[model samples]
Target: MRTVAGAPVRAGLPTPVVTYALMAINVAVFLITALQAQSVMDNGRGFVNPLSGAAVFDSDLFGRWVLSPLDVADGDWMRVLGSGFLHFGLVHLAVNMFALYILGRDTELVLGRSRYVCVYLISLLGGSASVMAFENGGFTAGASGAIFGIMGAQAVILLKLRRSPAPVIGVIAINVIISVTVPGISLFGHMGGLVAGAAAAAALLYAPQWLGAGQDRAKAVRIGWIGLAVVAIVTLGLIAVRAAQLRSEYGL
Candidate 1:
């Protein structure tokens, strides 16, 4: 088990408090959206009208909270973070929460709580930025983006330990395939999260060693944070650029 700043790795590790807290927040947000939507079971009306094959969330809260390029262009920047917590329906919420629970626990152990939070948030922001850049229009919502980031972080940890990353790669490949083939999935968001998460994890896992501070836990943690800040700044810059483009093009 690799330790960071007195935080032990996987073996007999402390409770994954941050992971649990994140899961709780996601669930609570989902419940609120479900209540507002008046339907928790179906993310879209496809269940109500299987013949139409149109997927639409029953909740109006989705529009206000979902990551919409137009809304972001209009300066609703909060949606970038808020949409990561909102879910379209029960199924969407359940799948994302399960993934978060599984990947987040190990990720929290590998990166420690503070670093784990940074990776998760940066991944979320990365996903939102990608959506803002490439997705011309639509309301996107779900934790899949952040979950994909956790997957990427786990892959980075495996590489750091000289362990095979085949399993994680396989999962990512499958998810990517689904994102491509699925009608409503956000491919850009998932890819963005994956790249951001891997980059953040790589920094947290390797920057200390590169800076000759691996043995010094305090310095290592500080360097890791600095690395995260770099990733965050870049992600924010991308968001700003995309938002400006949208505003300029749409005359918003």
Candidate 2:
């Protein structure tokens, strides 16, 4: 299987431990969503409301957890990060988890732990920013944005190494097509992730070389930490600024 292909380690390299852990966490979160959904459906206080047609998660715990643009504008900025881990439903969770496992495993190994984590957070925030800017509405959650970023990062490094990016580009193209054609899909989020992932990976791959520390694992780790900090700061700033604008314009 393609997923299995991404799992094996080579030349005594470390296993993709973080990748596996992330997959597990995603699954665990999905289980929570599922149970919550079931409770909502069972209780008379909830279900798909006839008026709004939105499922009421009993106490609305799950609903509150979504990346609500209005709520975000009110300073619930944590949703930008939290929403990446939340899925709307079972199918949504399954597909994203599958993609995460496949792409994350390989990317994690190639980038190593520190760099991989940095790329992921940056990409996730990128996607969140795009959604906040454009999608502007109820909660949108999924790991597709981050997964797309991983692919973009991989492509950037491969190109830098003079490797063929045809397969990677092909996959990205297909996904982009789907994002545009499919209903209820976040086109901006995917594109945001693509750009962010590529940018972060480029920094990781080239920054060290520029510093004359090419291939130095320790130096790479240091750069990864610094890069992550920079990305986090920039992301938070964007979210804060955009959220204020949204609040003012929309009166949230």
Candidate 3:
């Protein structure tokens, strides 16, 4: 039987619980934020009706949950994770949730639920770390970082299967360009997620080769965790270093 990362390719695999759960949570969070902000179609310029283009109230979620360098430096650490779930507006949330739905399914299929979650969370933190490092001031929020990571994982998995990763690479390139050119997009967050996702996926997919162990499921899982742990540690360290710099610079 053909296998992916030593996991047998079988029919009737379980549902992608993590992916759906994430989507639901994101939607729930957006509803709460939108209700509080008194607007469902919030945007950078302000909220608006997508159909009639009528102006609406501004979103308040960013104020509370966005990852701000100064706020992080002042020890608002939860923002690092919270920001990943926060979105600027309806369009932002819809785009990210769509990407997550598309990428999350295949990734969960290949990496399994647990490993996929590892890659997602680490990539999110990596994105937040990048924002802290480079974005001096202002707010950053959304799951684009995590979505980019999922895209990265798809690319890596294709390569591991000895297939051309041209498709995903093209997708990534287009998105990268958009990030660079778009006014409100977070380029650092996307790039950081891509790097972290690729690293984590590589660890999980290539764990057997690196560990010099046969394609045993148990051993592969263990080594994959080790790889993820390493990535997590590196991400946390970067966050710490950047936070310290901001604190010292701001005298916070």
Write down the TM-score of every candidate: 0.89, 0.83, 0.89
Q: Model 3, range 112-221, lDDT digits (tens) per residue? A: 77778889999999899888888876678899999999999899899989999999999999999999898988899899888988988888788667788675767776
Score residue 56 of candidate 1 by CA lDDT. Answer: 45
- 2 or 3, which is superior by TM-score? 3
- Among residues 3 or more apart in sequence or in different chains, the pairs in candidate 1 whose N, CA or C atoms overlap within 3 Å are none
TM-score, structure 1 vs. true? 0.89
Q: Candidate 2 at 75: error in angstroms?
A: 1.4
CA lDDT scores, all candidates in order? 0.83, 0.75, 0.83
In model 3, state the lDDT of residue 19. 98
- Name the 10 consecutive residues with the lowest summed lDDT in model 1: 42-51
Looking at model 1, residue 229 earns an lDDT score of 91
Worst 10 residues of 3 by lDDT: 53-62
Give residue 136's lDDT in candidate 3 (0 to 100). 78
TM-score, cand. 2 vs. native? 0.83
